[model samples]
Target: MAKSFTKMLRAPDSPVKLSKIPSDAHPGVDSKADALRKLPKFAGRLADLQERLFAQAHGGTKPARQNLLLVLQGMDTSGKGGTVKHVAGVMDPGGLRINSFKAPTKEELAHDFLWRIRKALPAPGMVGVFDRSHYEDVLIVRVRDLVPRDRWELRYGLINEFEQELADQGTTVVKCFLHISRDTQKKRLLARLDDPTKLWKYNTNDVAERKLWPAYQEAYESVLNLTSTETAPWYVIPADRKWYRNYAITRLLVETLERIDPQWPPADYDIETEKKRVLAS
Candidate 1:
């Protein structure tokens, strides 16, 4: 049997050296055409499973309390938005909740770091996608020294406990770190500058952040090592190739929903009686 993307991409339990892992490697896929060919099949399966999950929730009196939360974290221009557009966009919109986190507001800053994160969780039977999620509290917040050392340092354990609670409550947390090379990022950034249509996507801060590439990488390495728990493990997706990245994530989503195996709830009323009433009408 072919290996599952989940197994192939899942980060190891021990510490990982990001510098050693190649960002351009495309495992289990031959080429962009190969990935594109396989995606539609996976999309069909994904749509069906998503419908089953949503039906289970809205159907019978005893609703299933399972949901999925896909957390996307990566360096600048790692294709987080593109992944959402291609992968989660193919699923039923009624069953998907997408939230993109940005710089914290004054009100958000008043509360604990996870205050906003708690509100963005996916409802039962829904697939939630977080674009640059709670990890920012550690990643950017640490790299930029937005907060003091002791506070941000302690958030690692807090995040672990929070994810564990989600797992216990039937939430399958799929954390993916979209790994890309420095050169690829530079080309992508340059492309943004070269194209008038893509200028809106570029930010001056991106260049400034690029200068801190090594620091961001070090922070990511720590995140992968520290918070990759058994319940909510991290997957390092080689995202230099956009086609493979989309395909890998879609495969992971399909396998996860299949594992849940949500079923169609039986009708509460008698089918014969309903049929007879409809005929009489």
Candidate 2:
């Protein structure tokens, strides 16, 4: 059941046009209210799995080297931050590493593009969430021509190699591309402008970036096509409705952690002996 839901959301290997996918899709969900209602159930399961994964990694268990990394890529106003707040917020913060990658700082730029990305990877038994990740090198860098086409084009392969290495090292990578319609983006951006509370999120540059929507779409298509691998496949979540977005992502994370099937490590000492000692004390 979880596999089927994940299969439905996984991006196809063939080239895709973002317009072709519905931004408000709610597979297996009846309505917005239904999705909202179901979210907490999924969140609870995710929280439990996270605790087990953390325990396995830190409880002096032998050969403890498993972790989960969720990579989120999307246009501005596509709800990356919202997903983190709603879905990842349920997990134990001690076992989670949430990294938001923005423009490269001078020190970051001085090193390779993935230098900071590698440093931000979650340790064994941790859940790492990247709000905007290494794919930015291929997305905005390509659309805005921050780097030459020749250089950025080569990054797809490098990204694939990097992810493959992560998989080989026991880190399960789940990449999600929040797919929002142009109209939805416009509405969201406008809502930000109208609401004083959300005004801080309203960036004038977002409008400029929206102008190159077609270019951004093309760049993203290239990413989903080139970087979506067996080890680190990309899932495109419809983001028109915030409720559905949260539900889909929470479900995905729940399914993913279930597949990992982390266990609480066995006690090194005899449990009965420990219990007897505690009772005697």
Candidate 3:
């Protein structure tokens, strides 16, 4: 039997040391070629499952309350956008809700941190993708000291409570921490600088952010430890190899949807009557 990336990549209940984890390792895949070969099949399965979920929501007498939310968190250039392009981009757009949360706007900052997050959550039967999510309140905010120590410290519990609430309300939350080596980030950043087509992605702020990599890692470690719960667990994906990162995350999504096992809702109208009416028309 194939190994379950969901199990292999999931963050353990105990503390996780970022340095001890190998960011470039491909846990289940043999090579990049192997991952590339399997990706299309996984993507196809994901699409089919998403269709079932969408149909259940729109076509059922009692719509399914179940939905999915995929949370993607990583350092700069860990391929969160690339994952969305390759993995999520394949699914039907109608069934998917994609949100890329930026720094809080004036209105967002005025409200509780989760107020904006709540607004962006997926409706029933939809698959939601958050590229950089609520965790940033603890991560960048903590690393940059945007809030006081006591203020940010409390968010850990608040995040846990919020995620547990999501689970109670029928959202299957899959949070992935894309674990990339610092060296890989350096290479990617340099590539952005060197390639004309990629030049627009290059940012001076990214260089400045690199200086605080240690602090960010520390913040992430705390997040993985504190917020990883039974209801909304975190999976640490090895992301130095982009192909494996995509493959692993896609595998996780496929398995999760399969477990949900959404079915095509039964037809409300009588089939014979509908057929006869169509023929008469």
Candidate 4:
């Protein structure tokens, strides 16, 4: 039987509903060390793919622009930062870009939701990662009752159209939601509260919001349902284990960049020759 992550977890709204895989599917959970021992293989595969992406830097066109975009969305403590850091670490500086979005300022909230997001697009020949992306439109807005349910719900179509545009324009958009069990998340949050060094990461308010876990879960389920597509599929990662989460994200990114196959533009030999002749004259 093929391994299935979905069989184990509850279904999300995404068309490709992944129920949690049975415990028998991966007894690896019983041994964190053993499960972790498998990470190097996954990382190695990702590294190999990154090597190709690095080598192919400008293999595609004259201008050699690589417009790859990765959007990562997850609940707090889902290891979004860790995944992105490890994924981009293997690529050339020129091969990648990263944008981290925070709570919107009054100015940001004033404009259309995507107004701020569009301005952050990476230049040609770079893999741009959005730590938390426009999906927040569907996530936070719906959860906080900031917008009417119907209004926030409708943004899903707009998002699909927007991502489809990127796909048509040669940008490979890979989105992901780091899926951590609620119990696991609670434990992690509590750890943050207890650890002196990590205390600052813990916001008392976060616990308050966390108490409304059902609302957040519903919001995520809705976002996943409407947004997952062939052109821009959302990878639902198991993130209770940070190492596994990072490895999974790294693999997903490597696969997307490989598919894009960006290449550097070749120099115009005739123009160079003419310029050289003019210089000699």
Provide the overall lDDT of each model, using Cα atoms, as 2-decimal numbers: 0.92, 0.90, 0.94, 0.69
lDDT per residue for candidate 3 within 1-281, as digits (tens), equals 97898899999878889999999899998999999998899989999999998888887568888999999999999999999998898899988999999999999999999999999999999999999999999999999999999999999999999999999998999999999989999999999989999999888899899999999999999999999998899999999999999899999999999989999998877989999999999
Decreasing lDDT order of the candidates: 3, 1, 2, 4
Assess the local accuracy of residue 216 in candidate 4 as a C-alpha lDDT between 0 and 100.
Answer: 82
Where model 2 places Cα greater than 4 Å from the true spot, the runs are 1-3, 276-281
TM-score of 2: 0.96
Give TM-scores for every candidate, taking all chains together and pairing residue i with residue i: 0.97, 0.96, 0.98, 0.79
By TM-score, the better pick of 1 and 3 is: 3
lDDT of 3 at 265: 95
Q: Candidate 1's residue-wise lDDT over 199-248, tens digit each?
A: 99999999899999999999999999999988899999999999989999
lDDT of 2: 0.90
Q: State candidate 4's TM-score.
A: 0.79
Winner by TM-score: 3
Residue 174 lDDT (model 1): 96
lDDT of 4 by residue, 67-152 (tens): 77878888888778777777666566655678899888899999988888888876555578899989988888888888797888
Better of 1 and 2 by TM-score: 1
Runs with alpha carbons beyond 4 Å of true place in candidate 1: none
- C-alpha root-mean-square deviation, candidate 4: 4.9
